[model samples]
Target: MDSLKKKEQTLKSSCTTSQFCFFCTMKEPDSPQRRAGLANCFKQMPLTDDQENVLVSSGLFHIAMAQPDDPEFPSLGIFECMASLIQKGVNDEMWLRRDQNIYIPYYAAHIIGSYTMNKVEFAEKAVESGVIPPLMELLRGNKMSWVEQRVAVRALGHLASYERTFEALSTYEEEVVRLAMDLASTCVDVVYDNFVGVKDTRRRAKYQCDLLTRGVGGFEMENCKAEEWTSQLQCWSLYLLNCFAYKERSLNLICEEGFLRNLCGMWGGLANHVSPAGVGLIRILCYSKYGRKKVAELNEVVESLCNLSRSSDDWQYMGIDCLLLLLKDTDTRYKVIDIAFFFLVDLVEIKDLGDRSNFGEAIIKVLLLDYHKQNKVKLINISSSKARKAVEDLWDWNVERRRKERAMSDEKLEERRVLVGLIKQQASRLYCLGEIEEATRKYSEALALCPLSLRKERMVLYSNRARCRLLLEDPSSAIRDSTRALCLSTPANSHRKSLWRRSQAYDMKGLAKESLMDCIMFIKYGCIKSDQDQTATKPRSGVKIPYYAARMISKQMDATWLFATARSRIKESDNQCGNDEGQYYREEIMMRKMMDNRGLSTIREEPLVVKEDINRRKVERARRISKRATSQIGLPHDVGVAEIQCGGPTKRDRYSKFSSSDFISF
Candidate 1:
């Protein structure tokens, strides 16, 4: 105790001017006896790295918790200290063990983010202090937790929000956007594996759990905390991506066609849902002519947006904005405008869009770009099955008369059904004669004329249309048509031909689970011929799956279980690539590179040997891909999106009042 006091006395004497304010004397061992003859609040003292880090963490904790008006919010030399601790956490695993060091980096980053949230001056201080690189380190670190990541992204976002610090963050542009993309793609799974998935309390990372519980409580709070953090991490990553998208940097990489298809589906768990999620990125991309051109060409992207425009999803208007941007320009208005305009017709009556600028008028203007009005049909209350007629039975005579009319209707329906069958026979002949486009059109013509009551004939036409779509390289439409056929069956999802065609369609879209399940269900409809309508959903015991179904099952199993397999389905003989058994050894490698680097890197710099291996793999990948260069490819959950500037919740586009010149009066 006497020697400890003497040591403190010597440290107090070593205090320097700059270090003085950044540090103050500590109660090293925390005992009242050391209070003897002490200055009570001793002057700042020089300290070693470990000692200084402890002080930094303490200051950061207090500052981060403090409101913005507090005097200590951006204290002297604090930015440099925070930046140093973050770099240490990224560079030195050993330092993380020294005196609450893990918390030091997190707290420091929080303080930086918190202070910079409302002020450009504090953000400028952060940029000048070299906070961006270390923050980027934590953002891109291989082993950092979501806790660290969220703070890093938040700080960078605040810094990126400002005009002065924006250029600093852009130094590592490709790396930053790619890292955020990978994070947005995999954060849910990452949180699930570590915090949510583990059942044993002892196995979970203690520091993370402590941070989640905020050094208190248990699992009950952890679930909610986990959800909140998961959302923040995903949102902030996209927010960072949005910062890039706002500036239009790396559009080629961001605009990768396959990535765009997956982007429309990467909607997150929860967010400042007012602006956008993945669709937010799409909207930003649509603003640019190059982005518009790319977005307009992808059939799947247009179809996905079309579906969203009609659904109850939050980003419905955002989807409309993307299609409008595409339609608003003539150079980019190609195939998708025709496809999307069909869906936007229903949205023409929508109002109260909050500064989206003349919602109804915008949709109408686009619709009238090359408009052609058509006559509409109105059906009477003569009742072709509303199912409402049963409740109002004051009409006993009406029922008997309707039953008598129904017999005549049935006989006429049979005649019409026969005509549909004859047309189907012609389509089948065209299909066999290699006139697939002609066959597809004939099937559509038959479907248009067929009555809704003719379920079986419509099922056949839909199944035939799905096959034609597959050959035409339009898997989205094929999936839609095949799904319709399955729903039309007596027992939903039971038609043998529909199941098989939908499975093939799913395979074409690179959806393994959907394809595999459909194949299993197809096999379950035991012994049914392609032409046979009398199929069962439940498999018969001791019945063998047919040769074709067996072959399909093999390919689907390969798709679901193995990685890096070929996905292109052959038209001539129903052949699928990746039947070669040699590529099966990459099950582990597939997880590592699945979604093509969708997973976050676990380390900062690859070692020489690892880099060499990557080079060799790239060559081999090039070789493999060249052989099947024409096949349709798909991206994983990791392809992504974000908002405009993610300063805070990356606020939605600020809609102007109707009085503004930007607002169109409908």
Candidate 2:
């Protein structure tokens, strides 16, 4: 200790006497001189993984963290170095140790993104220098880690943002789209397993009190920053897809099955709740007729939009924007109204959103005109006047509660509030232990002791009891509790748990329409992000809209036909209950108008192709098969058959005479 202290005491004197300081070199701003120094630092080559990673990861991390606004690094060949480094790190397993080399890919891609963020010229140069392929590798998981994918998507987002390089990005569109979809869908759980939990404390402990703080922060700062990065990683992946979606580059891949449902549940909005996360990508997807049709076909997406439309978040207009686009064209309007109508009718009288003054009225007008006469959502007396008052109160958040005050003072109310929280916690533990009866009785006792002014607490108690009722096979009691909980909540039916419980109860009673309505309402409530929780990065209050709730809605939507009742009415009039009567309801001429108006005539619906397109492809394949059969058997090319002619030798017999390799396409 004495020897080390003497060495440290003279360290500055040694530097001064030697006429050079390494600390000064590291402190200098990004310049050609500084960058040149870094390049030389790696020239003494063939260092061990431990030694080399110190230089590589440290240099890349700083450069990535302090990225200049003026594009200093990319102009100095730093971008090319980072690109080369990512390629090297991905290929070499020897140096890619868990503690060291794993950071190379992350920092390398972050450097590219930080540089290309402000300038289009830099992104253009990056594409010219071959950055997309290596970045795409990180996205595709050459290492199979979400850590690399986080920065990889960020870099590609910058690359795709430029007009000069989007063509290059679209070159690998299908794979990139598929990989990004999987990442967006599963990255959260992937990160939670590997980086979170109690057993992984050592893995996370290495990063504590480090880079997250540029200096002055404390109290679990490492975990908080990791969480922020995870959120950004998820949102950035969506941002990359948003670039493709907004440009309408790969609508076929963006609107693929199950992704829309995944997109709806991605509630990790922007860091400060500045923008709702997946809702923006979905809104961009709705710009085209093809996207609109595909988005409308899914009940989950529409109901989520219906829910998000009521949000007090900054992006509230996006939800209304998507629903309006879906309802704009008459061809896609009929069947979607039943899912959107009741959910949206609550917003009909809300003239609150500043972006669009008359959106409420406009929504009703669009539904009526495009919904047609026989198959329409009648807007007359939609929500009750009491529900309208709740919605009005929702907008005017400053308005005080109108309930008659109890005799208790503020001191007694505070004591009661604390007591309710304790009781609820006890109930939660009992519920987790499967003590449904005890939990229900505890929640009821809490409800009795709670003050009337404590609406939020009382509502939670009622919702909890509703869950107990559902578990006890008491559907009627569940319905009453859920309804009371709904009434207690502001903005009418925004309580997700109660709505889900009520939907299940209604399903038990065979009330299909009511169950489906509550199902949509349930999703809509989950989509409502608030500006209040932005700083804390907290999730929504209730449990997520249940999976069984979503399944119930999808099942109900399948049985729903907008004109089923009207078709039966027609059969009764004509006494002709034939299948042909089903096709005569309305001749939709808007498909051509939709194609021309949206300019999507060039984009084919490969994922959800029309029936005629399917039949045409089938016929083309059939002709090719017949032509092959003609060549094999001496039959004429004029005959067309899906299966070979009976007179010709069977496929097995012909293949037996010739080598199997002779007909590889077959």
Candidate 3:
């Protein structure tokens, strides 16, 4: 242990020249090494009276100088060390010194404020022994400098948070309250007098009011007649009243009689002094139930705020935020909305250039939702339509601006491509969820973000979006996108597919003949004309394209007209020839026509056509048997058969004939 003490001493002496301490090197003295060293040193020699005095004075000096880098730096930890030293009776003489500057004791008391848990006993002993009295005396002294007063008041507030200290102070509650009130009153006076000639008197007054409110509120005055007493003080009084009225206890007291009315009037007069956009005063007025009764006066004040809001275009944003508070009360909601509407519309129309679009839209959405809930249908519809048009216009403007921007920036083009891809994915999910309108919006956004360089991708997006729009019953937009997709097609696999989609859009819009023309083109270019053998009896691979393209063309097919024309075309070809080859050709043509009519263009000719033909013949044979059986059952031939007819009795009919006899015999 002695060796450890010597080693500690060596570390400390080495630290002295290094302009730091051994404890400072460890970052935290609570660390095992630092704590062990401190304990060992304490047990080894203990601090002599002179050494303790030196350490305390050095700690105090460093704290005063705000030198946290010093080895004996005065921090909360250092204060804990001092309290430990005092508790151990290391140096009672220095601890009890009166002329050592009240800062030392005041700081020590302030430090004690943090000791609410186990340090109550230590605090009680210190107060009982008169260590706290000197600090109190310094706090109440008129000659204390501002810095000293701030420190003392903060320390008192801290100590007041403790249960025992606060309870003990409760015995002298009246006296403490009177002292605090007096100090607050004097502090307000000093601030007014000192700041009277200042250029920024308003700001100075606010700060002074804040300080006084904090000081008085910290005392927790029970019988303090703050309201009646504060009525005569103009700027500072109104400020403090506003502050206190927000406090629960003070609000309970101030709401009686005509106190809230008079307070509201004073706040209005001081409102100009407060930052116009700053709602601190407005918020305080709106706090209590009593303030609700003075809606007219509040409205007047809010109306006057429009001037401040109009002072600068930027002020309009802040103005809207302030107006939102007034509208929060159901009674005043409509009045505030009406007053704010004109300003909002003007902001949107005139300042639609920058961030105003978002702000305007936000405010309009709130008003519309509220008005709609109140069943004001006309107002709701008007606002909704107006907002929708505004949003659409803003969207177009943004798209045009971004288009221009991308033209100037290659980096922006890449970013736009990535964004478009993400939007397309989200659009697909939304479409799957049956949110057609939202999906259409997302698809439009994707198209706007897509660069012209990605023409193939852009074409696919347009085609998909056209499908969504058509599902939404927006045929005009669907046709527009489809046309754009066809125009923008490139050599990618989806180009001819876009033509088929455009054909579907045309058919949906009642342009069937135009759609048929596109289908023929799709067949010529999109489909492969295999020359191997048109009359082959085996299945073969047909042209491969996207499924959506196939579906689209199938949807556009004029089933009655196309079927008749295909059958006639096949018969005419067969009539122009005379052999088994012509018959086979006719069969192949009929099969191709069948697959095309069913929108199954992927089927090959050789085996699949033969299998499908055999299935078709079996189906025809079954129909004939069903017709013959229905005739034999004496049912009208015009009536469709309802059961399978294999020229045998049904199980239900046969069982009905023998059920009783068979059961008895068994």
Candidate 4:
């Protein structure tokens, strides 16, 4: 200590006594002469270790603190000198014996790393000058101290930032990526082995931290267990992996080796910094289907994504981007929906409309695919607002999608209108000409070109097509088309027309019951009391009286056929004596309609109670008649009548429609 102090004191005095010393050269006045002097002094040939040691001990590292471009500073030759010292210090055997010697290169690498940050050309020069090999050596473990590793990692990160240095680092990309995967895989294995009882993630994370930070020994050991320290190393490794993610070869190797699962595992223990890089890497990898399948297979990957999505706003979108890709797979989509539903709900609630729109699609897909219709109702019942909004937004989005697909500008809309009008006219002309096939084709063409929202035109088109279909003897298709027309038509006249056409279709389909129902509905809504009434109320536009009369008579004949068929079917069922409730109800309805149409009262003459009483009296009368006939060996019919006549004075007899109370009379 005393010898070094005396040497430093003497060195200061010598520097003060002479203006031609290294210190004076370093801090020379601003002039062309001084610039040349400083440059010449700094321009020394390849430095030896002995000279570097002497200069470092004499405070040579301070000179490197200023950048090379400082007005009075020396040339960039200082970087060469510092880089040489770093290279020698890491490579020398004796240099590791003293703690102070390690820092000489550590600080030098810092300066070099910082200086090369903004200068790609300079970084390339440094790479060519071989600064990467020494920095890489520090990163590789030959039992370097944490402090040494820290600076080394940082320096490498800075160098790797530039394209040129990044390329230089690519030589070691395989080793670095594998190293990270091994650490992460080790962490996953540890957790998996103890996974049964390790339910608390934070506790598990602490255990990982302890295992890493404290090692198996203790913190005081040379290579203390610093999970945080290891995490720093992994961050740089992941940085390299992130760059490699864009390269197809490296990415496939990373995935094929099962490195991505370990990457996902890092989320629980090292999320704050590692997650963003890991997520970005996975996002890039998922651009291909196989990579997405691999990522989706990893355990707790969805959980990690949910954690990231909940961590911050920026991660939320990035996480969802990855999720959308993963969701393309069926199993992964269900898992994501199952585990992350509430988190996604929260995201949708807080995000702006744009993000919510995407979230809506995801939610709808999950609900549509994973849940059955019954389960969907239950899910909605649980979170009505979220489910409802999701459905509504999805519908609105679908509508907008269709709208955009049509690209319906004003010009296009006008052209479609003109085309639709001409097509419909041509179809109508063909229909009147009895060319049913040609008319059907023209109507279908018009429908294909028509806008989806034009309900009235679509209804007319569907109705016209159904007429053509009916002419073609395709009753099923005609029924479908007419039913659609009825659903779309709002006006009473259109409803009546649609109902009549549909009834005709059902009759042609041999569905007497359905035809009857349509006829009833048509009368119910159209209020057509009779064929004469329908004609009187019908709109008389462009119709000759003969055509109107013929049309009305045709509709009246169809109505008569439908009613007679329904009534005969009901009567046949009633006579079968099979207790058919449907037929009984149909009969009662028909009776009511018949009475109402004839302007007659709907009330029945015999009260229900009186009818029951009359039935009992008739049974008693039959029994008495049998007894009278059996009592007298050959009793005359007149004698049985006399007994009934004697009993006819009873009050029940006057209530009966017939004077006699026998079963036949009643």
Q: Quote the lDDT for 5 in model 3.
A: 36
**Scored by CA lDDT, what does every candidate get?**
0.58, 0.59, 0.42, 0.50
Error of 2 at 379 (Å): 11
Pitting candidate 3 against candidate 4, the one with the higher TM-score is 4
What are the models' TM-scores? 0.51, 0.52, 0.28, 0.42
Q: By TM-score, is 2 or 4 better? A: 2
Model 2 residue 416 lDDT score: 84
lDDT of 3 by residue, 105-182 (tens): 333443443332234554454344433444455456544333234434444444454556655544544444444434
Candidate 1: tens digits of C-alpha lDDT, residues 275-295: 366788888888888888888
Best lDDT among the predictions, by candidate number: 2
- Candidate closer to the true structure by TM-score (higher is better), 1 or 4: 1
Taking all chains together, the TM-score of candidate 3 against the true structure is: 0.28
1-666: candidate 4 lDDT, tens digit per residue: 234345545655555433334545545576776666644544441243332343332354344345532423324454566566666676775853453354466556656665565667666776776777777666664544334444566666666667667878778877756654553344323222332123234544333333243224431221122323444545555655666666554665778535675565343221123345467667777766666767766646666665444332234467667766665565455434545554444333221322344454454464344344345453343234654555445444445546774787878777887899899999876654445678889999998777766768877888788766765667666766665565455532235556556665666555543454455445445433333455776752221111111222224333333123223433343335432433343333333443354332231212222233221134235445435444544333222222232222223333245332211100
Please report how far candidate 2 places residue 555 from its true position, in Å.
29
Candidate 2: tens digits of C-alpha lDDT, residues 60-158: 456556764655546656666667768877887766654455556666787788878878888888888788888988898856376678889888887
Write the number of the candidate with greater lDDT, choosing between 1 and 3.
1
Q: Which portions of model 4 show Cα errors greater than 4 Å?
A: 1-24, 30-46, 49-75, 179-231, 256-258, 265-277, 287-290, 311-314, 328-346, 353-666
Candidate 2 is scored at a TM of: 0.52
Give the C-alpha lDDT of model 4: 0.50
Query: Which prediction has the highest TM-score against the true structure?
Result: 2
Indicate the residue-level lDDT of 529 in model 4: 35
